[model samples]
Target: MTRIFIQDKATFKTTARTYDDAGFLHVPGRVSKTGTQQYLRRELGLDGDPNARVTVYRPPEEVFAADSLASFDGADVTVMHPGELVNAKNYRKTSVGLIRGPGQQDGDFVKADLVVKDADAIAAIEKRGFVELSAGYTAEYEHSPGTTDDGTEYEYVQRGIRINHAALLPAGAARAGRQARLYDHQPKGSTMSKITLDSGRSVEVQDEATAALVQDHIDRLQKQVTDAQAELDKRQATIDGQAEQITKLQAATADDQITARLKAVTDARARAEKIAPGVTFDSIDPVEIQRQALAKARPSTDWAAKSEAYVQAAFDMAFDQVETTDAHADQKRKLAEDGAKVVTDKAKMPAYDSYTARFTQPQAKE
Candidate 1:
């Protein structure tokens, strides 16, 4: 939908006037200002096909019956606070008849006759003191080159406009009249306006008041963006700090593991030295010792049992010889004699048939 603003300072008449025996709130439907011209040629086609006409009708909700020409019971009316429609409330509906003035052209006025259903609404209207009208439309237009009084180049609508609906809005001064000022053909020095065309060109046709309002809106948006960026940066810094702390913790854990392993190696070496006097185990690494112990503890083939037994016998013989001394000579001689007897008896057994003695008798060392 396209919006058109037609402000009539001359016809802000709130006192009910009589036209054709019906109470009327006659407001200017259209004005010949530059803004109205643009709205007409661009929004409500005053420059369209001669046969096609623009109609200002009531909204759908107010229409009680539908005919080839629709009929409205009344217009939707509400009281709005100054400068904003968001605060509009205290609604009362009254029947209104749309009256198009003579000439039916771009600069002509359309009037609305208040049917005066509710005396309370009329009393409220008089109490408010000021009122405005708003119109909703749908149209298509083409842009053409134009120049302002100062010879500044701009674009204006060249053709085809149609208005769908117009409503008598109360307390709509901010949107209606303020918007109209922007498109004024000859804006006063204090008026501010801004115009943007379909061709991506923007022209500032504003006065001091409008300029200040626009700047205030821009400043608010910029401050919001700045605050959002600061929040994002703060969160990012916190994430970075957490990452650094995790890295330090990981490094500390690794150092602790290395220290534990070194302590284990030192303790193992100390124990080995105490167990075996005069024997250095310089090649012993704690990690390798653990690995060998794990390997020996695991399940292996059948040959493993026999290998362990043979190693145990060799270790026992070496220990006995190393521990024997002059104080234990008699015990050593007796152990030797018993070992020789066992060997001779084993040689005489059935499994010893292929075994041959290859030892010489002991020689006396003088």
Candidate 2:
């Protein structure tokens, strides 16, 4: 991307457009001669091309990619150059690893270089993508109508710029690493008005089928969790029925198989009692005690008291069961969210209110 910068100076502030690619400074309004030298050195900080001949104050001729370049040969375009300042050129040279190379010295330079390479200037040139021409004078002879004046002579050569960068053209026209077709003519000014380059565009393609696949996996997992919970509920009901008959058995009245069945219920109850943080499970309610007593009551006159205790036990068991299911449901909900089954479609996913409304929400999306 070409960045536009506005610079101001004393003796009349003017807008000079500079581009990164072409190492040129486009200054409008007769650049004040008094400050022009300092302006080129300080403001534009242009050094002549390594093989260029022009100084910073060297009058810049408006040349295009097709123009010949002869006078500017060996010209090092520099904002500043070493040893050129017979007086003062104090640009801090970061001497961190100066001589770390095969043909270099220690405490040398990085941001600054001993000899600025044409490759470096070309780097900036490629960024702006300009065609270069040599700047030499060529003489053209013409007969004077009333006076004896011969045509002026000039020397020039064809200049080729190493392309730094160019904007891409849409519709598979222009691309990088491939030779770009050139336009026939050179631009008039240093900067042209809305002239576009030929280069490619990039885009991301997503298929409708991909989104559908994610939704399918979400539905399958939710169904598995739902089926598991329903089956668990059915098993608990069966255990409740068997526990009733076990309460009446005394000593060896029932077989060992019945005893095993009763133990299963106790074990399940213990598993459900695992307390969740922040939730109190120590308190036992009357309802749960009555339910347990009723399920374990013997065939005797104390059935009422036994039923009361059973109800209290039932409440505690119910609390634990409820907690477990809630945890499992939360886990499933989070899983669903990960799989795109979020809760409160309007709040989580406004796009899926209708379809996901029937399914549960995942915890993660929340």
Candidate 3:
């Protein structure tokens, strides 16, 4: 048994168009009939030869099978076959109405009720006389070449018929029309129209009004996604900029620390050189330099047990004492170079004698 997708057509000549309070048009009709000879073409990848034409028998047992007829209930009703299987993916886009009743055997036909919900589809049916329904369904084909009771000969017999959708065909549309096959095999832009957006993007749909509605929804959703992405990109840029600034600040802080450390080391070397004026103290540790200065000031003192702060204080005191003593010695040398200038004038002599008398004790007259 091979699964084949099939479509069959039947007409209804009813002028009794009625609507419920909800403004939906209800039309009672027979979607499929039993004991009909449908001309079918085997699509590619089926059991028989590809594209082979054959007459298929639709017996009442398979047509009015409990499960098969119930499959028509709640199925989609399209304005025309979108030339593809009506499924969950494309159902919203293709469906204009719905088959509302679980179909039952009405004599030799499967009778059901369908509701036309779309205004455009209702207008097409009421005004344009498109009152024909073609049932699009799938069935297993059993290769049994036999003649019917009415002498209708067929090569393939349909079994396990399951209805997927019932399409309202246009006036003069036949069961063997090219729209019975999948939409991919149809010619470009023949059964459907294209909707072009502002971004130069296009979408193909079965009709203009439905395609416009679908395109409107797509545009709104696409804009929302695009806006969200843009906001995320903007926030990311700000974060990147802040990170770069932080890195630069950290680098500058490191450079400043290095400069301050080098200045401290240079100042320490200069102070050590002043403490012992001829000592080479380059690359020497600051603590070791302080110890050497303290040792030179007090030659007999041990500095090994002293803390760094104590050693530094001792070295500063020693340097201050040496500087003071050197200043006094220089003053005495200047006085010796200018020695023994006697004053002859009476007023100057008296003042000089008075100044010298403070440093001399009274001598006994000899």
Candidate 4:
């Protein structure tokens, strides 16, 4: 069974009209006002054969009626060509006319007489096998829940339409069928389900398995994102831990440097005490002693020897201040002269029998 679905507006091919030289043709606009049995059974709320064929024509009684020759009321009934109204002068008559066809009831027809001004336009309509009609109407939709022969749960429904106006369209110009398929309320053909959006649009679902596959792909991508975020968090934690360890190591290194410096100062003070026995090095700050030792200790040199030399020089300078005897004074003068060798070409040791010998000679008593 070929099940054809329709939307709110549906279009179908109708009997073509022969072009007359008088610019008029008596063609059937609609054969049955209640529609055919096929439409009534399958889509409408009437009992009829689903395999029956339907056509558009006029009934005989309405055409032969007493009031048949009335003036064409172009006011209520509009004659349109391809969804557009014809010129007022082009329209001749619009009323019911007899159409010789099978199963046509009394007054169950619509007919129109239109004057074709353009010969080419009328010839084009003859070339095509069908004409089209558009009607405006409201419908009361009904849903009859039932199961198919294969036990598939389904619903059969129909629309009780009350048409207002039917406009004649040119051949192959009607968009109602395509528009119905796209914006239809019912899912026809092989479509099994529909997804209605919040914006009042419906989407037909043809393949359920494909939709499931797409959903699975989305879930997997979400999981991968979660895993990537977790990995990033783990890496950040490792970096934080490494930074903390580096800070602690730096603090420990600073403390070790301070301890080593303090030890060097204490050792330097002890050596200074030994070099100058009578001098009191207790008043000197330990930091200052450390600074002095650090200033003298050069790379690739003997630090012990350099420290002893520096202590001995300090001792000599302090011992020279306390000397009172001439020998001690002479020793002090020799040491001062020896220290001046770098700045002046002076004797290494001054020649002096006593402290007075080192002084300037007095003038001879003549």
Pick the lDDT winner: 3
lDDT score for residue 156 of model 1: 41
Query: What TM-score would each prediction reach against the true structure?
Result: 0.26, 0.14, 0.45, 0.21
lDDT of 1: 0.39
User: Sorted by lDDT, highest first, which candidate order results?
Assistant: 3, 4, 1, 2
lDDT of 4 at 4: 30
**Tens digit per residue, CA lDDT, model 3, 126-231:** 7887777788888888878998885657887789988888888665654422222111222244356577776788768775435634664565567557868999
lDDT string, candidate 4, 1-366, tens digits: 222332122233323355466664434333123221123344333356865532211123432233332212221222342232233444444321122322222333333333333444344435653245444333443445554332333333323333333443444443232111101122333444454444556666565433333433444456557868999999999999999999987885797877976776676576544433333443345544533443343224343455555645654453344344446879989999887875464333354334446465675678
Worst 10 residues of 3 by lDDT: 177-186
2 versus 3: better lDDT goes to = 3
Off by over 4 Å in 4: 1-22, 29-124, 127-130, 147-156, 169-366
Candidate 2: segments with Cα more than 4 A from true spot: 1-254, 261-265, 268-272, 275-313, 316-328, 331-366
- Alpha-carbon local distance difference test for all models: 0.39, 0.30, 0.71, 0.40
Candidate 2 per-residue lDDT, tens place, 41-100, comes to 222223454443211211122122213122222222222123221112332331111111
lDDT of 1 by residue, 301-348 (tens): 232344544544443443445456433987888999999999899878
Q: What is the lDDT of residue 351 in candidate 4?
A: 41
Q: Return the lDDT, model 1, position 163.
A: 28
